[model samples]
Target: MEINIFEIAKSSPSGSAAVTFMSYTMMENLLKPDFFNTSNDTIKTMMSTVISATLPKTNYTKLTKPVNFTLKHIREFDHSGSLSCVYWNISEWIVDGCAVLETNSSYTVCSCVHLSTFALIMQTRGPQKSDPPLELLNLVCVIVGLVFFTLALLTFALCQWSPGVNNVARINICISLLLAHLLLLLTQKFLNLIRPQQVLCAVISGLLHFLFLSGFVWMFIEAVLLFICVKNLSQISSKKREVLSSGFLCVIGYVVALVVVCVSVGLVPEGYGSEHCWIKIDQGFIWSFLGPVCVILAVSSEYKHFHMGC
Candidate 1:
């Protein structure tokens, strides 16, 4: 599309030479307009470089040029206008950046500064529609998961405190599971709101990593205890059970998980905060969590089979 832009007044010393605003009327086939913003520094710098390379270096000069840009992740947008302003839904929208040229006229070209989803906002020439239903469904599911996890934690707490309950290892397992689920659920629910805060996101990701690893380690401890109980059913007694107290179980389960999480973080700090509040799938860091869980499941399955044979 050909963009016709005007020059700004030279009297404005605060304006940079490279910054230029383009206002153009859309052709019959062009998409609608919207503003773009992002939190990615690399994308922001890239957009600035692209604009500088495309435009003439002179200040306050009106020049028309053919510019083409390919922006990644441009299918996401937030609607903020009435039906009279915006009408069409974007399908595979991907543009670098856009802004309102004038409220009355559909024109404004802005620089892009972040790696974000590109979206197209079209004017209301036709019917205006609302957002899709899938977003609502995701929110509902997260809320439901939060409620159920809360109940599970409460039930486990009561179980731990009940009379004749001597196995602290099982209680520790439940504690780790509940904490992991609670943190994960909270992160999922509020991630979008706090996404701009890189430090907060990194912290959340680290906590999630630690909590989940703890859960898995506790599960392994529970499996070991179960196997021991099943194998030594005849030798069980109050005096012998002193070796397997709650203190011993808690130390083993918590310490192992802590070590794994600390070592993982020390080796690859950046792996915690790039995407959703989870470890980056790149490298083999993900296996730190997956490997232990797989081994625990395998041992548990073998124990189950052995118990069934007896």
Candidate 2:
């Protein structure tokens, strides 16, 4: 058998020689065409030449088609054969085109284009199943928290019997804590129903942190006041002094909480949870909350011992 490889050069001067040889080999295997026929050789040679000429240098390009077929049967093709042919042509085109682009460039373009196209395709497609919608969960939590808070508030308000100064301070602190939790829960519920507005989320998160910290500080103050009252039972009897002390402590708490929360959010805006943003405890958990709690407990214990001794 004799082959005129020079004919491929005449037909496809720009073609990759290697590609032409590979295609010819493939065609030979499939057709087993008789090389004795000049016409058959010429046809095979031309087809191989054309394919080589079109072959790309780099094997990278974005695939524009969706992974799944989104088009309706009627819209896609009038006949089944036509649809099959179209899909085959599309596949070949993607394979050839992808060979030309740089790998990284192709990947980035493919990802971005696919994402954009997928969004459009999804619009035409139906709603997808998501884990029991967040709205439902948030709604349940908000309702429950609100109900609990309302009942708690009413109970606190309706109780007319005056409590001791320390007890009154503790009640106020509890009320603040409950209110903070309620606000945090309500904000979270709203966030679930709607896409978060960054500014609003930040403000609400900051407020939540402030309130929570303030509540903690108030609790600490109540502990301190109780300790002082027990230790100096005779000297700390003035109602005005007691009220002034509580007020002063509250002011200090607010200031301290504001400073801490501001620093935290400023440094890392989303460091904490979405529901109740605060300084992340894990990083410096001991100093943030545990240290203060320990100090308060120690003070209270010492005061109790001193009083017992007296």
Candidate 3:
């Protein structure tokens, strides 16, 4: 029932510490001369010793002190005799001579090693729940955006209804935003699944970036067209030029965005964990999309009011 304690050392700059401890029964088992110098026959004798020590008459209850150890210095330990040794933080500590009685019935010692290591790594490196919740909300936004977009596109294409040039441009802006939301949805979904394939992750990320950039470019075009219609009514007649220019700009923007995303994030697929496959929107990615749209909206708003004044 009693436990013994021994201190090894302080761990590192991290200030963690290591210690060793053993139960009385385990210490007695280790004291046996043949405990370490064991063949198959010797092991059978040790097993018998352990079984005899664990009998009801022995009544060994627990250890006197809990072993404390840092994870940094754990090396291999001997688990071979009446006493099982656990090595942690470069120190070996013994448990009970009959500790097999306390061991989980399902897991062998070897299997426990692999499973415990896997669980520890996952706990340290896995995604936070906070962002995933926001991603789920974004997904819902994308679905709603798609529905509105489809309705708007259908109205524009199929219905004879013609809103004014400005209104039509606004509709285009809505459609572009909708497409952006859809791309966002798809990117978030793929990230959630945690697929392990590198090539597939890169392709999906590239497509999402391309689509997102195109959506913003289209929005800018809509704004510019609206501005021209309001402030420079004469220039509105050059709709053919406007359409051609917008098409060229959209293509160029998407190509550039795709190239950059592929080069940066796509090239290194393994650095970040499975949760993140795409280029994060930290360095000018937001500006690349939002900046142009903001400018277009500002110009369009000013032009619309100016025409109203006239």
Candidate 4:
């Protein structure tokens, strides 16, 4: 650390007064309750201890000339983390008079106009420790579900049921749900690579929203059809058929989801991606996806009383 006396020395020179340097490694616990603004990321000090350098005789708050400080990194450096030159300011740590000059994996050089207790802080986007078992479980479950979904879709396509039975809703349900689950698993597995690319993350999140919603819509349609079939089995064998046409059912299956996603995008353009590759929770943006899901579920649960006129 370089401490140069500029105008302060010219006005009231410290002369031969010695500058004292002290490391408060043991006293770090006392200063642990800090008010550093690090958003949501986990924070850690680069060095194991805090250092204090002060001019014993002549004390100054602001210096006329900028000084430089080199803080060595004690822990392993992370490429995805951010580093800052911060100092104790009363009850908190801030970088008001300090700026990062040069940085490397080993150490960082900080240029500041004034000095106090100084240290280097690092912030990383991920948690300190992750549960490997939970992650493995999720991966295994999603893969198995995807395999079953694919098999169901293939069966629907190849197997021919009785002409009296309609499989339009079931087919669409399998197709949309399979695609949605696959996309979700892929996005999560590659989240680290995709999150940095803002535009790509946003697009993927929007696609996921549409696919999942479409799946829900198809499921609700199929549930309503099942209810009708269970209640009116004798009329199901009509030659001309009693239900809506396949084309109309197909359109309704996806159109509702598309419309909701379009409106959500129009209302909050920046709410597509966030901490995860999904709708951000900020500004009630998550409600857009949740609202439709809740509506579909509520309606489906009460489908027994609803008349389909089929």
Candidate 5:
């Protein structure tokens, strides 16, 4: 498919001569089309291959004039349902920066101000299901866990410890996990309200991403400390302990996670929020959270095993 990017040369300030416009079609199986309540009204859908248009640089997203695309219909046509031009927002198809210019049985023309994976979908109403008892069970479990986390944190804070005991990592891990779980629970509980406010939903997701990852970082920190303490107490002298101060631990715990979330946002801002107000699974943005978690799990497990062996 050809795109009408009239000012692409202007969009790219490199002033270098450009020769080609990049475009690709993705297989339908690449994305899951499970529309999870992205609409209370009729939802439009069409089984079509995903299309991405790109220039030399990323600034093609915002333009002086919108880009026009002639998306040929690849699905069987139904006259009864209406179709709309949409771009995948990682979680679902949305028409935020797109509009349908023209359509027919065989093709539809779409005009979008920003560039993204664009497609056409037909409008159809569908039934929804709710299991209140199951939701109540989930809520109860989260609340119980939160209560225990709070109690543990308080115990760490109020109780006196032996002179050599270090609770820095434990305390921070508790805080991070507690906040992360609390934010996630609240996000799900009031998702209906949060979903409509896209900015808030994105912010909540980013915070959850950072908080949860920070908790994992702290867990890794605690595991390393345990390993070090057990493996060789003599290696970490009082001077070395002074170097590995609480402040240094806190930096490693929270800053590392903050940097990750920031970089993820820089790479793909839309990856943060979705219909459910979490990381989007379509663009593999979920890996921003999962990648670190998996690494921490492997490294932490190794540390624990070594500590046990020692």
Candidate 6:
């Protein structure tokens, strides 16, 4: 019937002091050793459900272990001014529902909330079930895509014997696309776990948008390069057709993507995603990506048709 409360004082700068206390209460219906020793599964299950709801939900999330309740009555002031028991290691005291009252009574009633092993178990609920086939399919697809793209990039980079304008364009395209897909996959899988950090989420969103846009930009660059190479096939050795190089083409592709991403972010920084950490699809912000893509696709198609017609 006796509840023990432990009070600890915490001091802050600027002349401020606060006290945190932990209270442990015993329930005869739940904490009795004989009650848990029953061989009846139905009775134990019912008691667990009852105990889970017995704790006040307005303050505490889960119930602590039973040993936290034993306390001795003391009426004195020690040098440390702390009346805590060594058995009170079951939970760490929090300030959620802690208070101290001045009274002339033999014992004080205190309510406190703390995090413990039971709280973690309650928060986790139970083991989650997932479809094994679906999980395996998703894993296989990601692994295959990653491997193929990696090999494709290595091949494009290592093919030094037949290096040409087209090969250079393909290499840049592969690098950009590879980075974009890798970043997108990583962010999608991991960014959701750290939603509490706003700045980090924003940075992740910006990077994903930039990388994806860079991928698309490189694709567009490849298209243009293809068109130019085809158009100048007959004048392959002409100095006039040698204006663009691999490095110059890379600069154009990356710079264009960077400028678009930077301008979009600067104009409406909030346009970056909120929940999923991606570009916001609303408020014309997405047009920055779609507009350029549409223009490039149109130009490439037009040039292709014209070259074919000639």
For residues 1-310, write the lDDT of model 5, one tens digit per residue. 4444556555656543232433345544554344423545765466456677655444434556787888788776554356777777867767787888888778888898866676677775543466899989989999998999999899987775765667888889889989988988988889888976878988998999999899999988888776666655675845556767899999999999999999999998778677678888866889999999999999878867776786
Per-residue lDDT over 104-183 for candidate 4, one digit per residue giving the tens place of the 0 to 100 score: 87888988776578777777665436579998999999999999998998888778777656788888888888888898
Candidate order by lDDT, decreasing, is 4, 5, 1, 6, 2, 3
**What are the per-residue Cα lDDT tens digits for candidate 1 across 2-23?**
3333333233244434443332
lDDT of 2 by residue, 171-247 (tens): 56667677777776666546554223545655765677677677776666766676666565555566546554656
Instruction: Write the residue-wise lDDT of candidate 6 on 1-310 in tens digits.
Output: 1222122111112232222334334332333322322222221111111111122222322323222222223322211122211111223312233333322223333333432211100011122356788867866776677788889889877767544456666676677667767766676567547545766777877776777677777787777667766666556436523557667777887888888888987898777755566666767777877887888788878977888899
TM per prediction: 0.51, 0.44, 0.43, 0.60, 0.62, 0.53
Which model scores highest in lDDT? 4
TM-score of 4: 0.60
Per-model lDDT:
0.52, 0.43, 0.42, 0.77, 0.76, 0.51
Report the poorest 10 consecutive residues by lDDT, candidate 5: 15-24
Against the true structure, candidate 1 has what lDDT?
Answer: 0.52
Summing lDDT over every window of 10 consecutive residues in candidate 3, give the lowest-scoring window. 114-123
Predictions ranked by TM-score, top down?
5, 4, 6, 1, 2, 3
Question: Of the candidates shown, which would achieve the greatest TM-score relative to the real structure?
Answer: 5
Off by over 4 Å in 3: 1-89, 92-124, 130-139, 160-180, 190-194, 235-274, 281-310
In angstroms, how far off is 7's CA in candidate 5? 28
Model 4, runs deviating above 4 Å: 1-128, 233-243, 306-310
Clashes of 1: 11
Candidate 2, residue 239: lDDT: 54
